[model samples]
Structures are given as C-alpha cells and as structure tokens.
Target: MKRRALLSSLAAGSVAALAGCNERGNATTGTTTHDDSTRTTTPTTSDAPTPPDTGLADATTAVFETRDRTISLLGGRRRLPSGLVMRAWLSATATADHPARVTATLTNDTEYETTLRLDEVPPFDTTPHASPGRDYDHTLYLAPTERHGFATTVPAVARAESGGWYLDGPPDRWQPEAVELAPGETLVGEFAVVPERPDSFPPGRYAFGYTDDPLTLSAWQSSQPGPTEESAFEDATPPAFAEQSPAWYHDATPETQAFLRPSAERVDAPAAVEFTLHNHRTEPLSGNVYDWTLYKQVEDDWYHIAPWAIPVPLTPLAPGDTHTWTFHAFSGPSVECENAVALGHLGGGRYAFHVNMSSESGPTHAALFDIDAPAVSVTPTEDVSVEREYRLVRASTPDDGGDRATLVVQRTDDADTRLLPEQVMRPRNRGLRNTLPFFEDGVQKVRLRTTDGVVDDALHGGEPERVFRYDGNAFAAWRA
Candidate 1:
C-alpha cells in the first residue's frame, strides 16, 4: 500500500552521488571536478511504468543523531595525528525528512592497533565517534570524562577496538579499549543526528551542538592538547597468565547435575554450546589460553572459535559456593555462522576469544538436561455479549494458585462457555493472543493439571476457565 505519483520529472539538485571521502590532508586543496556533460540524472526516464514517490530505496530513518560542533585545537591543527581518523557532522535528527546517518569508518592505514582520539577545546561535550551502533549484536559504552584515549573496545580490532569500561561521570564520561588492528581492514558503525523537543521547551530554537551549529574540532589538536588527560583506567598492562599458551581440559571430574535441563528454546547448542560452566571442584583452574573445539552436527567436521579461557588464582572454593564462566563461538566457512553477544567482564585478567579449528585427541564433552519447567495459562472465554462487559472476564488459575485462588471470571453465562488455551511468554512480552475459533459456545467445563516440570520454582504456567452465558451478556462484542 503506497501513494501513487501523477507526474514524471527529475528533482533538481546536483546529480553527482557523493563518493565516500578519505582522510584529507594539506596535500589536497580544491574539489576535484569530473568531466562536463557526463553528470547523470537520478530517476531517469523509464518506459516500464514509473515507480511511486516512495520505494524501499527511498524509505529511511535516523535512529541516532547529534547537534553540530566546531572547535579550535591548541595550535590550529587541522589534521589529526597519524593512526587517527576523524569525522565531524552536524545535528542529531530522525523521522525520515530529518534523516541522519553515521558514516565514520575505520582506516586500517596503520601497522598496528590504534585509537581515534576525541577531545573538545572547551565549554561543550565532545563525541569522538559518529557511528557506534551499526553492529546490532553488542552493547556500546560512552566515556564519561577524558577526551583522548586510543583503541577500540573490541580487543581483536588491534588498536581500533576500545572496550575497557570507564565512567567519566556526568558532564564528561567516557570508555576506552585497545585492539590489534590490521592494515586494509575496516570496522564500520552508524548513528544519526537529531534535535530535542519536550513539553517544557517552548518554540525558541534550542541548539543541538557545542558553540558552533554543526560539529567542529580545532583547539589542542594542533600542538597536541596539553597532557591534562589521564585515563581513569589504572593499569595498561595485561595479566601474566594471559601471556601464556592455552591448555585443553579433557578429564572426568564427575560434573554433577544441579538441576534439570534448560528448555529447548533456551538451549543455545546441542554440543559445541553449553550455557555456562561452574567451578564445582575445590581447586582453582588457571590458564593463559583456552582452546575450544566446536563441531557442526550436520557436517561432522570441527568448527573453531576463540573461547574465553581465564585464570582463577590460588583462590579456594568454599564448599557449597561456586564461580561461573561462559563460552561463545561463531560460524566458519563450510559450516560457519556468527552471533552477537552481550555481557561485560571486569578486566585485570587476560581475556581473548580467537577462532582456530584444528584436530584434537580427547573424549567428547557432553551436556545433561538441567531442564527448566514450561509456563502456560488457560482461559475460559475470550468473547462475550455486549451486555456482559461488566460481568464476564477472561480467567486462569495456575497449578500453585489453584488452592489459594477464587473465581477468576465472575458468574455470567448460564447456557455455554468455552475456555481459552494457555500460552508461553518470554521476558518483557505481553498480551499475545490465540486465533483458534471458539468451539460451539454455550457452557463447557475445562480443567488444568501439572507435573514436576510445572511445579518447579523456576518455571511458570497456569490453567484458567470461563463460563458462557446466553443472556448474562457481560463480554465485549466481537469487532467483525
């Protein structure tokens, strides 16, 4: 369903599609002009029935945006230092017509991992990146205070990914990390710029950026901003263990099952993936590297990923207490896939996730069902006559609540009633409906039952019923 166009004409504007820009230097000055008469026109004349004003290509929006900014570096420095890349854009915006997109891309022009510094001259809050939300699988953090820190939060980016978490706190907060970046490889993210409008702010123009309209950076970048910056991050060094090689644990220590298996829907893997492992034993497990051998169930070949191998120093495990750790792996060529991850780890220990598939000699690692119970609900009736809206209600009684419960739906119909089916709901979701038609309504009896899976404290489910009244008239009229 879309609006149709009546006339055909080219919109006026430079038809030149903007090619992406590179790190500009003093070496290049004027706009490089292409040959004349060769410029192209968009929405060119077509014979196969013209397209509507809106198409998938034309529909876009801004999810992230910022106001504009401009700054004066200490010595009038226009270009950032080597191993650095910077992009300044104006305004935060959204809602199609006010579209904004972050196009800051990493330039692998450096030999090793590097950091893109973020510093504001004065008075305004500084943002070092234009696109940090492009990748949807992970979480993004902002530095609170210091402006200049190199490296990406992701470690493998080698100087590009800064992942260490730091709180600069209100007015000036930030986070930084280090990654091993390689040449010619680029990591990209995106954002949008937008303005703020609240019931309290009147019709006056509210500036979106610091000092200048769009964004600008100048001060201190020139002679290198004075060294007032000191990362809240204390030690820049990694733990001694992370520097050592990895060892594969392949012995039987009798891992006892604490609970039933997790639900199939909650289970992440059949084999290569185990939710998380706890240190049930008394001794501490220490290792510099962790190597995991994953396999594709269908392919029968080994898959590889850098599993998190960490160290637990001479710390003793108090009987009845435990420590937990998780491992994640992604896809590969013939049988490969990658997934996004969430969850943060406190640093001080060496943490790395590398993917390397190789042959191994050992007994297979297996999983036992520590299953979780299923959740459900039962309802009596979903529909009622317009006359009964005040009396009839959808009702359900869970197994546990049955003894402690009373009438869920008030007395209404006397002729016939159809009970509703139960459904499973995940975290944060609600109001899901079932489309099964009511079975010949009048008044019918429905009941609920359960088992250990239904009674577990960790599981959720219920059973409910309804009475159908021919004249009680207490339900909402079906909106045909």
Candidate 2:
C-alpha cells in the first residue's frame, strides 16, 4: 500500500478540540488585572472566599486553590514561514492540598499540515511543551527576578520504570523525534514540574516554568541541548534517499521470535523502513516543495502507490543536512480481515517499496527501500473436518519486544507452530483478545476439531470462510 493510502485513516481521525480556552467569569471581588503576562486576583472579604469561576477568563491569572485545577499561564500562536500555524498555552493544575501543577500545550492549527519536534528537553526544549513521565522532575514558580539561574536542583523524584525498547538506550538518553500532523492534529504531553513535595513550590509569582534545579537541568542538558548548528537539517538542494538502503525489512530472527512469542504480542502490519534523507544542495532548505509518491517494484516494473505526507508544516534545514526517516506501512496493528485485502499482501517474493519525490519544477527521485520475503506455505489445517488454516497476524506487544509477527498455529493431528513472515498474513487486528483470548492467559494448547455446520463469509454470504471448534473449549466455533 502507498504511504498516503496507509495514513489516510489517521488523517480522518486527527481532529483536536480548540475550545474551552478563553472562558471568562467574575472573580467575586478577587483581584483582576489585564496585564499581557500577569494574572489578576482580588482579595475576597471572607477568609473562606467563594470559589471563582473555574473557567479561566484570561491567559494569566485565576483563583488560587489548594486543589487541582487548570489555570492558564500564557497563550499565543506563531505563524511559521511554511504557512503552518502553531498555538501554545500554559495551564496549571494540582491535586487537593498538593503542590501546584503546570503544563504547556503546543498545537498545530487545523488549517494546514505541519510537523512538530517532541524530543527536546527544557532550557533547550521548545516553549509550550511539557516533559514526558508519570511525575515531573522540575518545579515551576514565579521568581522575584529573571535569570535566578535557569539552573535547577534535581528533586528526589524517582525515575519511572517502563517496558519495551527505547531507541536512545534509556529514557534520559532520548534523542529528538518529530511527528507529522494532519490538519488540526493536537498533541498534549504532560510532565512533572514542581512535584507534590513540601519544598517543591516556594512562594513566588508562579508563572508557568520549572525550577532552576541544577541536577535536573544538568541531566536534561546532557540529553538534549536543543538542535545545534550541527544538528539542524542543512541542505541547500533537493532531498533524496540514500542508495542501497533497505528502508523496510524484517529485523526478527527465529531466535528472537521464540523469545518473544510467549511474552509479547505482534502487530498485524509490521512492515518498517529505515532510510536516510540526504539533501543534495549547498544551502539550508525548508518547506514541502517536493511531492512524495511511493511505489512497489513488481517483477521489473515500478507501480505507483500514494505517499504519506505530514499534514503539518515543515521546518527549515541547513545545507548538507541528512537525517534518517523511519516509515511504517501501517499506522498501527491491523484489526480486520479486510485490511489485508486493502494491503494486497498475497503471493510475496521480491517485492520492493520505493519512495519517489517530485516538484512542480521537476522530478527528483530515489529508491526509498525494498524487502525480500520467503514464500508462505498456504494450505489447509491437518484435520479433515476443519479445512482453512487460521493464519491470523498477531498484533505486536509494544511494551517488551518492539516487533510484530504472525503465529501460524497449524491445527493438524500433529499440531505445529511456526512464525511466518508477518506481512504475508493480512492485518486482522480485531483486538488479539477477541480472536485469541487464550493469548492473554498464556498460549492454550487446545485441540482443533471440525464442526458439523458451515457458514457464509460475514461480508459476502456466498464466499467460503471456515469455522472450527476447539475440542477443549466450549465457546461457539471460530471463523477463519
């Protein structure tokens, strides 16, 4: 399937709510100010003043509370050179009698396609962004003066534990990664700032910012000091893919599958491509002037497929800039049988995927990548009663192992288990639980037997799809 076709569904579901902002109400005699960056509050006559409107009226100030609530610290939008619009706002919330909580949201306006970088940490990280984690490590407070040392002391916040393969080794060692957004795509990320501790938040103006803790700053600085002159995309010319690169291929081996099969789930569509984009020019470049088109090489001919484009705007790059681009054939695990039909994943051999780029001025292209596959032995299960093989692709368990595979459960008298090439099986991701509930409880070695009745395909009544029963289980027969 073409990249564009593969990502079309994502585009359809990317709408984000931009309301609930700029809500206004009376402060009940509390202080109200109109400063661009300052919040307004009026002292209530009663020590137990009535709660002000929870709906924040302005970008800055709101009623102070020991409980958790979202307070706007700042709000604004930036228009980039690529015609993409960027919106950012800071909000504060805290649990009851807990330390104040703060978060920044950076959104891509729904008007155009754009890309946003999410991999940077503070000081060097972009504004209107919150760090990732269960608890934020930095404290946010207003200071009597600016530059009280952007330095911060790392708090006693424990490092969060996680499962799965993280490309940058540890969470602290993460590198920058970018997301392509369809029009109106909104991403909200939260981090722990001024954790719920006694000294986490000191008396101050309490604007939307983290503490200048030295330890915290040091760790983030070492990890991501922002995109440096050497890191920005630098290419004064057209962008092209590198030569002889296998953009998409199966990285799993038999041993890895054996180790992962019992422990992790697999994804229906597991095709992945890793290739570098090289800028062949002498000047820095930005913007999406080139149109991307994907193709599959069948036999000797190159067939066209749609390309996946980020609905968001692109950032500028420096000359001679080259960066790796990882593309997944499917956005997530395929949950239905029809997804296979859409992907056209039958009869596989040396099929290769190529990404081609074109511009109104001219065509500049490269072979994005390709994959070679072994033939799948499509045959009936052993039992004479149940004819069709239940060769469903498994959704990947993203937590432990980072790859996907299809567990070929051969139901013949001498039941056999084999790990087939994932793509050969269609994306049937109707939640693995629905198809293989036993998978969650651990693999069940139940016997397969043919049932007496036959049924029509769910969609096409005339078509033949087989249904079988497990000798050990008492549920209705399953369709294959």
Candidate 3:
C-alpha cells in the first residue's frame, strides 16, 4: 500500500508541475534553487516546504536586473566553480514599447569545446498562466516577490510517449544547435524575460537567475572535432527546358508531371500564377506536396519573393488527383531590409516556383517553374523584353547516393544556377516516412484543415498517442 501511495504521489507531482505550477512556495525573502539548471538563489521563500538541496557549487548574485532605467546589469560578471564565467544584461530597448530581453554570455576558460543546447536550459519561468503551447501561454505573471522561482521542468531529452512532459513551448526559441566553444572561446545566447502581453508585468522589481548546468556542454579534453561535413552535387542531371511560349513550364518523372503557367489576368494588374501537379501512375501516389517558395528575376539576377501556397496544415493529393497554388507574385532583395531597393512593387516579372515532394521512394522529384509576366504597369515606352531563357534544371546528386535531388534555374552554361541562401536544402536523411513538408501545396484539401492530435490532446486534456507520426520539421496527420 505504501509503494502504491508513493507512486501515486510521484505521478501527481509530475502532472502539477507540467501544468505550469511552481511546486516550491513563492519566494518571500528572494532566493530559490533551480533544478533545471541546478543552481540555488538566496531569494526568500514563504512557509511552504523547501525543495531538495541540489548541492550545486557556491555562486554569488548581483541584481540580475530590475525595471529601474538608472542601473545596468550589462557588465556584471560572475565566475562559476566549473570555470565557466557568466555575464548578463538587458537590451537598450527593454522599455514599454519593446518586450524585455536578457542576453546571457558564457565563456569557457578550459581547453576544450563545449556543447550547450539552449532549449535544455530552463529559463526563469513566470506563473499563473495557461499551458505553455497555447496562444495565451506567453502571459507570465510575477510571484509578488523579489526573486522569481525556478521551474523544475527540463527539456525532454527524448520524445515523450505522451505530451505530459515535453520541453518545447512556443517561447523557448533557443536554437537547438549544440554550442561548441573551443578553448577560451565564448558563447552567447539571448532569452526573452517579458511576456508578449503588455499587461503581463507592470513597473516593478524582478530578479532573474539561471541554473548551473549548461545544456549539453561537451568539454574538449583532447583535440576537438572539425567543422561539419558538406558535399556538393556530383553527377547532376542535364537541364530540362519546357516548350516555347505556346506551352507552360512543364517537367515530369515517371510518376508525376508538373505544369506552371500564369493566370488569364493581365500582367499589368494584380498578378496570380497557377501551378498544378498531376500523378501519371496508376497506384495511389502519396507525396508531401508542401515545401514551396517563389523567386523572381530582375535584370540578370534572381531573388526570393514569396510562398507559392499557404503553408500546410492540409493534406497531400491522392493518385490521379491534382493540386494548384495561386498567389500574388512578389520580387525583392533576397534579404529584405528596411532601406533595400523596392524593385517590383506592382508585380509582373519572371518567377521560379520550387516545391519538394517526397514519397516512400525517398525525396523523388521537385518542381521548378520559370514563367514571365508583364510589368505592373504596361507603360508605352517601357520595353517588356525577356532576354534570358527561363528553364528548370533538375539535378540528381550522384554523390549523395541518390538520397536527395534539387531543382535550380538553368543558367547559360547549363551550370548549377546560383540560389539564395534560403534556397539550399541542408543534406539530411530526409527519408523518414512520417516527415512531410507542410508548406503551401497550392491545393487546399479538406484533410489539411485538421489540428495535430498530439498538440490538441496536450492542450485539451485528451489521450495523446502516435495519432500522427511526429517529425521535427514537418506535420504528419493521422492515417484513417
């Protein structure tokens, strides 16, 4: 009976903590211990039971920060016993207009590289809020004390069978990259302290501190490993050009054929383009129809502009089925800045629409559209001449062991066309069956309208199982 009772209490503790409740009492004097980062703060606590001592090394604290504009925590530095020096400060614009941000820096005094994952380190959490993944979850309320309490929640090291103990919330935008700092190298990351809601915190005193454990720190004992391996496409296929003006942009694999053409609307007006994918094979063809973007050509260069379709929460097309994505085409600097030149505000230009469609056979084929549209305004003196030939160059990387293929524009030399930074797909084993790219597939199917059951169940208190195969990059829906 005692064993059963203990198990019950353990389960209850996990549930209450997952619900965003700080199990420790509100800090009255202004110090609390954080198990997430394994550090202790001297904050005063109320008469509630104290949490277990984490036995972390001794650390000192200065005022991490407060609302007073007069003082600054920017240069304040502290050295941990582990030889990691930490520094934190507020941004210049932590005022009412902008959200509060805290920048934390760590310097490794030792000789090796350290792998620190930002997501695993629990930030100082505010309470009296909704669940973490919801829209209103950003509304963090203070504990009416000098120091905020530490959350026991840690990033789930592995996928949870249920949604009860998942670490990722929308606000935890910590880059999942392992921070590997070489000997004497410094690593810096920023965490947001204020909630998006203007009313989350009023003018007040709040002290924030972090835990001792740096997430996934890999100390360099010997010579550190080198940079990640990258390979270029070898044995690339030749450029496939579509028919002349009488036809639209067309390309095909044994299973599917894609056609891209401008809508009947005049080029001078608000423009739209039509993209269709047809399955030519007899068996049911299931390919992730999402993962698409658009780029436009101005003069001699191509720049990324817009998404061809609304990103997916939708379904893929069935065999003998078709999908279409239509949108007002745009063109601008590949990297948008406030002062960047405004090139094609009125629309009408050459565009390249690319989509990645993968199936059980691996990432098979992608669509590349090269189409010319009239300028935003057809001025009498403006010459609408297209000098360059627009073609889609489908290249199969022979070096990648046929695991991946890419679509690029066809340049004059039939060499691989230059692609914007956002255009490159980092090589990875994209063969995972459950991983479906869910960007706009152009076709708005009914199945895509459903919510992810895992997230839905987590927020709504329902049973969450493998209703859909979970993938970090794409959304996979439940199979009927």
Top candidate (TM-score): 2
- RMSD per candidate (Å) reads 25.9, 22.2, 24.7
lDDT score, residue 197, model 3?
A: 42
lDDT of each: 0.22, 0.27, 0.30
lDDT of 1 by residue, 175-285 (tens): 222222345443322222211211111111122233332232111111221122232222223221222222112112223311111112122222222332222211222
Question: What is the per-residue lDDT of model 2 for residues 266-369, given as tens digits with 9 covering 90 to 100?
Answer: 22334544443433222223444233344444434444333323344443322223334344544333224431212333233323333232222323323323
TM-scores of all candidate predictions against the true structure = 0.18, 0.23, 0.22
User: Which 10-residue span in candidate 2 carries the lowest summed lDDT?
Assistant: 256-265
Task: List the candidate 1 regions with Cα displacement exceeding 4 Å.
Answer: 1-79, 88-93, 96-99, 115-180, 195-214, 217-480
Q: Which parts of model 3 are misplaced by more than 4 Å?
A: 1-248, 252-266, 284-290, 298-302, 308-314, 330-348, 362-480
Model 1: number of backbone collisions? 93
Better of 1 and 2 by TM-score: 2
- Per-residue C-alpha lDDT of model 3 across residues 77-106, encoded as one tens digit per residue: 556555666554332222222223233445
Residue 213 in candidate 3, Cα distance off native in Å: 54
